[model samples]
Target chain A: MPAVAFTVVIALLANADIAFGQPPGGRPRPNLPPIPPKGDTTHTLTRDFVPASNTKSETAPHDNGFIQRWLALEPIRKEIQRNNILTETYIRTAFAENNFSTDFNVVPKNGRKVKVGDQRLQWHALDSKTFIFNLYNFTYAINKPPYGNIFWLVTVINCPEEIPNVRMAAGVNSGGMFWLNGEEALVLSGDRDMVVDNVVSQPLTLKKGKNIVRAAIINGPGMCTFAVRFLDENGSPVKNFTISYE
Target chain B: MKPTILTSLSILVMLATQTSAQIGQPFIHDPSTIVECDGKYYTFGTGGGGLISEDGWKWHGGAVRPGGGAAPDAMKIGDRYLVAYGATGGSSNHKGAIFTMWNKTLDPNSPDFKYSEPILVATSDGYEECDAIDPGLMLDPTTGKLWMSYGTYFGYSRMVELDPKTGGLAPGAEPVDVAIACEATAPAYHDGWYYLFATHGSCCDGPNSTYNIVVGRSKNVTGPFIDNVGRSMLEGGGKLVAATEGRLIGPGHFGRIIVEPGIEKMSLHYEADLDQGGRSVLAIRPLLWKNGWPVAGENIKAGTYVIQSERRGYALELAVDMVRMPVARWFNRSTDEPIKPVDTQKLEDVIGDWPSGNIDARIGDYMSRPHQKWNITPAPDSSGYLGAPYYKIVIEGTNRALAATADGKVITVPEFTGAPEQLWMIDQLTDGTYRIMPKQVPNSNEKLALISFGDSTPALGKFDVNSDNSKWSFRAP
Candidate 1:
């Protein structure tokens, strides 16, 4: 091993199996090692990272545990996307009034019914997952989110091992709601920054294989994207995972 | 007094202001016409008010505009400033009315700050095919008439002519359909080609917005503006100007600032900057004309760079004999040991090996050698060509500088003298390559073109028009 790799190993050993946030089943919390406050840029780039603390940050207050590739869906709400006659303020107002529960986690299993924006949707056999929704609008303009509007994308994660007492680490911009295995997980509403590992979810169970992850992302007429990864109980990345699109 | 953080910060801010006049502060949306009245620059935005810049940078909001609407355009018409905007348009307000007013001066402190009452120019009474919003103004150079283009994504984008003297509608002027398929249609005249620029795709969604500026040009100001590919603006045919790919997205409402003749910059509102919490902020980029069409270029930033020749991507270096530095390997070096910093090859180690004469320029494989790097610093006080500051390109960490010679050759001088030959003008081409031209050579009127003189030799000659051999790209090691 090179000196850089050796130093990284030593740092990992020094931080191994440390107990994190409280969770059921005594599983360690899935969280990231805290970085020093924003000013010390030099030290922050070093391998010996300090553990996280609950420092109040207006942009990224909380740290996410894991960040990995995810799939997204084409945006819905044709009424809003039509020449933008429905207007972004109208969709933003509806999202502000907390009216997006109807869009989250439409269908985890293939052939399940999901109702969204006066339309009933179900997972088709051809539905697939993508790496990210960063270019969903341009890549899928047919049903992509138009300017000044809102849309939803849901992804399914298939984990090999059951990740007990784990937290869903996500970086979401412009606010969104998350669901796991058809259960409501967290709601990050309001116009917020999408800092990496920005939000940590409450204790959740990632069963062996085929876990449904759904997101109803809302943008007030700008860029909207979400990054997510699974964290194991021991403040580390959960390995052996793939995603599904059905 | 000892230098503290506050004092050092103050010095940094002062230095920054003197270097770049049109950057580094004031995030705004839908900015109005940027005009220099006295020594200060002023612009009105949406939301009824405006911002004032004392030194062309570091803006603060104190000025005001009438109508309190969105996407306002202000023009200096003779002795007064003509301002136009949409009154009730908010994406889908077809009932919105176009309004205009006049003010003598933009400064609120000026005695001539009073604005005339808002006069209705046009209106879309909620039932028309177009929603009257997002207006842009232009003064026809040939006809000396004022024209405004206004509409929304609701339907047709239309243009109407006005009398320049009174800012009133011209006789027999009706709304003529100019462009469709986009919003924020702005008209401009350049070299007999009347250009129409419009913002395409989604806006207001922060990072998700995909706003880009597209353009079409015409020989006449009014009808049938066409793109380079011969697509009409009325038929959704537009050539792209600025689009998303980098950190900023949804650039809309094109504004032009003329920095002397042949030099210009374009201003627009990026719907969301991913780094700035998705807030709509102002952005100004270098606007250069290529093939008779205006294209945006990158802002020059101070940095160290590995100047690479565009043809073969070989790095530029001092024409000196190569001495391979010995690489030492320690048998006892263990992986468990902490890493130590290694000293980079210094200039002194190679300076003695170089010929004691005028050093020429060459292209070679990058070896992180001291001769392969250059430092580019913005020379703002000294004037160069249009719309850009002259730059001083010096050998990294050394006094040896690159200069263009009278005989169409490049040589490294011992020190920078701020001479015309030592000043380099860099402009980015539409394909993102930078063409660097020296200020002047003894009797030549062309730029320094870097070309291959055999296999590995890089020689300089007069620039060949639209030649790839003349462009270079910078890669930082």
Candidate 2:
């Protein structure tokens, strides 16, 4: 039995799964180890929204337990495909009359907020989870003509993942530009007549997760209207995504 | 033909001291007149007033005409001369005429200036905001017929016909619809095509002026003209010619045609700011024909015009001048369709019958002179009873087509199709008189022929075809 066990151990080591201890399930499985932490901070939490310092030890600002929970949602944001379709969301808070600035600090999931200054942030999922935060836009208005004649405003939105092997078109009059992730996507410009159709743009990359997108548009001479739609690998619209401008 | 220097100077004095002297008159843009008899050239343009030169070059400014029709565009038909002007009749209260003046000779030195009579061609039909003016004349070389294209009120171009001998409207022919312009002017012809060159967009809008010249061409003298890019002028379509280039301002009211050179070359005269760039001055340059169309001179020889001129013959600048008679008012049908003369009134019966009643045995044999190829021949007897004056012409170096006209005077045929109306039949009277008649003209037995001043061949006495005792080589308009 000792010889047989030694041979099994040797085989297991060679296969890169050999371990001496049993897993938490108490089954004789391969070595079970903890996933490396992505972010720096870690913390322990109980029920409710109480600060961690009020209940647990505040000895170190970094808590390994909090890091694991925060990183649990991080892998969900990874895209399956390469750089085809890109998706992103921008959140801007409304300003008061005097106009003040806003700052942001990273907050891990299930971790207590550390009050460093005037900034207020809470840990939440950034992807398809219910814990994701929403974005809003502020300070938008129209400008009159002569000086404002032939004006342009461009916007680009990113996708959660990359899409592939697809042709895309965007039509606008006034004009608009699109960008995917950090690379250039497409530019649609000029005086659009009654028959405005078939504007060619870059193909989209659709991954399993989040992608970055942006657009810029301009109004000229007369009224300005701009809208963009994407096509998939088979030149079909991707479903189940909502566009929110706040 | 003595050089009366004193009379010439007096005419100059009369020109300089004319009414409004130089102010508030309708500004004539590009004044150019072509008269055959006296071989003289006259110009009346903006600020330049009226000028005449025995030769085309050395010019002396003449007086501004009374009531003001600025730039004088003139053409001569037979013994009669006519001038068309703009700014002369563009007013709401003014039912002003086209400011037409007829002269017997183009000679500035001739004392027979009594033939210079001023008459309005026709007032606008009370339809538009502009009047009938800025006339361009083209004579169908093949048929000695006159055509006059002009501009009118309501932001459109208009046209009318004049009798070559009487200086009146042709019988049954009235003012017809041409093209339009935003702020249009200037109409000219080149090759066998009548080029309607006009200005589009805003003209006097200062630095923001959108003034530019656009052009269209048609095979018909009265056009369903198409531009270089295949847009019809009658459809308010044109391709840009001389637009506002760098430092050029208010470039409008242009005159363009192939210049008189030993070699084939085109030239355009336009008004624009010179280097001083104030007001405007007349400027000209050679134009190039590309892809079977014309582009400005600047575009060619600057590595453009991969194509070259392939047409022969000094494409003469001639206008057919038909004498306007009271009978011509009802000639043209209002529709765009070509109005055919009565079929029973074929060219043979309408014109004087040939002695042998055979066109091939008489005119065809005589017209078969050197370099004068006939495009028409007699059909075989089996084809049907041969008509008296029906002859099928096959001109040398051209497409095979039959020529049919009433009296070799006026032939009204559908432009694309070679209908019976395309036939020509000249009637000869016993008294050495001839009347060129269309196939089916309504009532008139004698119609005048519009002739051009050019040499068809040295053997042919004169380029004018309508006159008796001549066998000039004539081409289709």
Candidate 3:
């Protein structure tokens, strides 16, 4: 472990983009007035990656629910799963060409296969930095590509018994589609953040026993994350049920 | 003396020294300080969830940290525990805010465990060059004032003063920029220096993640912090503290606990562990000082041990000369005497020969008697210094405790009193032997450290870390 830690320190010292010991001697921002420790303008090291500040699978309570326990899979490109079918084509596009889409009806069938019991799915459990299943860094485990794309995240909600009017609120990165039991419950296609249940405006009704939630997340070139929760009519989190991947 | 509070260092070491670290369960991100409440250990993580351990060695998910956003930190102010966390401050949710609440206990089931309403301490408008996330809390030992450091790489890391009593911002307090080029800012104080430890580099990349810990020190809680090179932290000056462990990447979120005068431990989370399916887990490492700068020391390996007093090389024994009754042997079958359960040595059996108040703690031959045999276990639950946990020394096969009396004498108490006299901070010296000190010595500021008297008698004396009189080795009996 000491050897590994030392190697990282040395490699960081060797990287010019991330000059560790350099003094703050550079240009200033045009719009934002210079802040403290002036003379510093640009720092790519600070912009390297967005710390997944809220890495919780289940965020705090709100007027309604909580988003927790998600079993995410590695990131998969959007080309093949457009319009609910595998449409493979020659493409060298990156985040600048953020034109990507995923249809719940379409099954990409090919990516990193995850073993869920005896069944194998196109996506596998994303190695999350926290138990919350952070998707932004979750994708780095698969590949380094344009941040904006599509991901097929799968999670199983174990409802002890049948319930009526259990409102489902969700937060998705950028935007895309949401499915409950293979049925399209909501369609969000745009740029956005995973705001602990950002989709409360469009509430969802869930069935009891095993409820399958599949998120077709689309990002333009930034973080890819999502959260969902169940709530009662009063907007308090309905936590009697368990959130599981199995 | 009133029982001293259990510091974070001692509690973490209780399990760290004896067991292989179990960072896998509950699989939390950014775990909070390991705390001992109600004789058990508990810690909160991101996602409004946390973990608990009956023994420091095995942790499972069950703790509840209400209102969890990201990278939360916790500290006890008085009888209550105050937890602070970032509500939102990310690429998507840029308008970040730090929230805090206090609960008497980490357990939601406890009757005294009601959490106060969340209080807003600070906030950051995404465009303000500071994103208020990953808040780490510190209660200034010098002034008793509360301070919190919150921010991410999106902008500058800043420290905000908080009301120690209310878990809110102190009057007229404002966020002050302390560091940048990192996130999860933790403020730790040693001697006269307040060390600002933070995370640098890209995190959350599984095995590919390059997250490492860096540190800077300042004289005041708020500062113009500088690194070992004398470069300012405000200008990205930080000395490297720790980084990756081969396939393990991203060691972020710094938590410091002092076990003794010279021993400290740093706690953090590994962004990803290749050995654990790239899953994230909590990690604790010994914090060592070199030339006044703090660095991580080597990991500890567990071994069976016989704890002996350093003074005269005598093993810690029970107050009872008390006898170890012989079990029935084939040759001396007790069938003629009617078989019955045998009793361990009792205080009454040896009380007549010893002093009236404090039993004489003397050195006897290494006979490996049940009373002579001793097992040294980590008791993070016990009070200690630096980041190491104090040890619970019990007579093997019995509960009689070895305690240091107010008169600076070592004796065996009848039972485990859980008092300052019984709680001992055992420090391993340079030569591998140890100096055991009581957490408190009645009302005195001086620590009652175990020493070898001229006659090989066990007693307490003033401590000098380098003295051989206070050092004892742990041997395998």
Candidate 4:
């Protein structure tokens, strides 16, 4: 009976590895361009992001209603058009074909690997100290050019009770698309600069338990950053919820 | 004998160290005129940064300016902010260039924050008569034209016309020499006169800097500014506008802030603040007008005073029953009788008849009564307004505080609770009289000042500067 139980556990572990599209023992190296040297002292990068550790508890949104925690994937190289030509139709057509798996229901764990075309990318859980997450500094820290890249981010919000008439308010540099609970919530597509409350989603409900939020941001040839939070029906910040990476 | 001398010396030193400058980290040199933006106040300084204040009282440094320069001035033109600065000469060399730029917002965190490229408005060669620095901007309210005044002590202060739309030198404009022997010059418009306020004497000497602000006025925008004594500023003559006061010394770089119709304030930097380790610090004082000329007013010192209403020459007092003194029969009082001093009405004598609860306030004839004397002191743990700290006005030797009610009535609560309604903002108006306003009225946000409704009635109402009802005076009891 013990031998049978051990076999069942091994089978479950192997199934999980296969589901994440990762090898059992090690991650595969993808063919990519060479990284540039680090920036000079004039480009002082803010130390706002830190690796999400298990010992830390859940985080709360900022007083001004800004979310600052997410599980972000490394940049994926994409040959996108210039900012002026990036219209809603063009972005929708470019994003119609899936670059990776669309099964966002499963929360990606930290250090978990996934395959996008021939490239192997890993998820990084980070807690941002600032309201606006600086994607330029994040890419530059890893010796990669911060322009003309795409990034995916996800977060879990736990509500005490069912909340209705809540909207997602976001500001993004370049363009972005957001999804809540596996449903399309907001799409901000333009060659636009970051402005507070630039785009707000339609009113939606948050279930009593956990709700997942996923987003994809595309940038081209400029400083890349984004900020997001939830607002109530009366346009006030909805801060009575905890955020975590599930 | 030695101990007494030491004690006297310590008290003198302590008195010399007491200052009434703007609170918080208000350290800045050559500050521009304060401008209000998006519910906050900003003032840029000489270097490449400035200060921001949420309440106009406690200031800290967070303001952002791009170009590295000396003596920058900021103004809000329409929906955009225009900043002018001198890029080079503040030292031995006289060659410098003055540039101007525009920004949608002063807040660095805003997405609309981006400064337009600097436009060179004016310049000076090394041998020119004027060193192009310390630029001050004024958008003419009469003709709708923009003008800039820039120069230094190297030669003559000059004025030039600028295209308000582009923030550049106006077409076919030339520099016109306005004044001599003055730097950090700014232009102001009040009534029908155009005033040229400038700084004179030596600066940067800290404790020994002889810097003082002087002014001259003219009917036109350019040339022939005259002082009060019929002396032209071109001949090195200027009427003294502001000088050293209390622990603050060497006032320079005059800037004006019109808070309302009658309340005005002047902003400048003291070359040395003895209480602040001789650092250059920003100072804001009440701007009073005497005989149609600008003069710096005094900040009220904490003391006991008889609150007199300018409307009817009556004093603000508790509405309790009047207590009389012992009467002396006057039938036989005559001729060669030795004079004896009759004591004034004391608080102890009146306490027995007064009620120990909330009492209404009234304006009555002044007789130096105990209830008419108010002990005005700075409220502890209270944030201030623009110029000075909020004060708590209580009856002398009692905790009965002067407060405002929800129904626009003035009253005195038995004990001072340090509530918002109990704090008062006593501002010395431009006419040398004062306007007493409560920090907040109960159940309302409308700022109401203490007014003389009638001869014997004290109420809170909208302050009208022209009416005598809104004016008050404080006299030593």
Chain A: TM-score in each model: 0.52, 0.35, 0.54, 0.78
- Fnat for every candidate: 0.00, 0.00, 0.00, 0.00
| Whole-structure CA lDDT of model 4 | 0.75
State the C-alpha lDDT per candidate. Answer: 0.60, 0.35, 0.58, 0.75
lDDT of 4 by residue, B78-159 (tens): 9999999876525333566788999999887789989998888877654444667889888888987888998865446898
The alpha-carbon deviation from the true structure for residue B354 of candidate 1, after best TM-score superposition, in angstroms, is: 10
lDDT of 2 by residue, B38-82 (tens): 554444442223544333323333423322343346565566656
Winner by lDDT between candidate 3 and candidate 2: 3
Better of 1 and 3 by TM-score: 1
Please identify which of the two predictions, 1 or 2, would achieve the higher TM-score against the true structure. 1
Better of 1 and 4 by TM-score: 4
lDDT of 2: 0.35
| Stretches of model 1 off by over 4 angstroms after superposition | A1-246, B1-25, B306-348, B351-372, B377-394, B397-477
**lDDT, residue A39, candidate 3:** 28
Which residue runs does candidate 4 get wrong by more than 4 Å?
A: A1-246, B1-25, B328-337
Question: Each predicted complex: what DockQ?
Answer: 0.02, 0.01, 0.02, 0.00
Q: How do the residues B286-392 of candidate 3 rate in per-residue lDDT, one tens digit apiece?
A: 77666667776643223335656655666655454544446556465555677666565544554455433444566655655555655555553533333345566
Give per-residue CA lDDT, model 3, range A30-133, as digits (tens): 11112233223343212222222224332232223343444444455543211111111122122213322233333322234654334344444322332133
Question: What's the true lDDT of residue B174 in model 1?
Answer: 88
Q: What share of the true interface contacts does candidate 1 keep?
A: 0.00
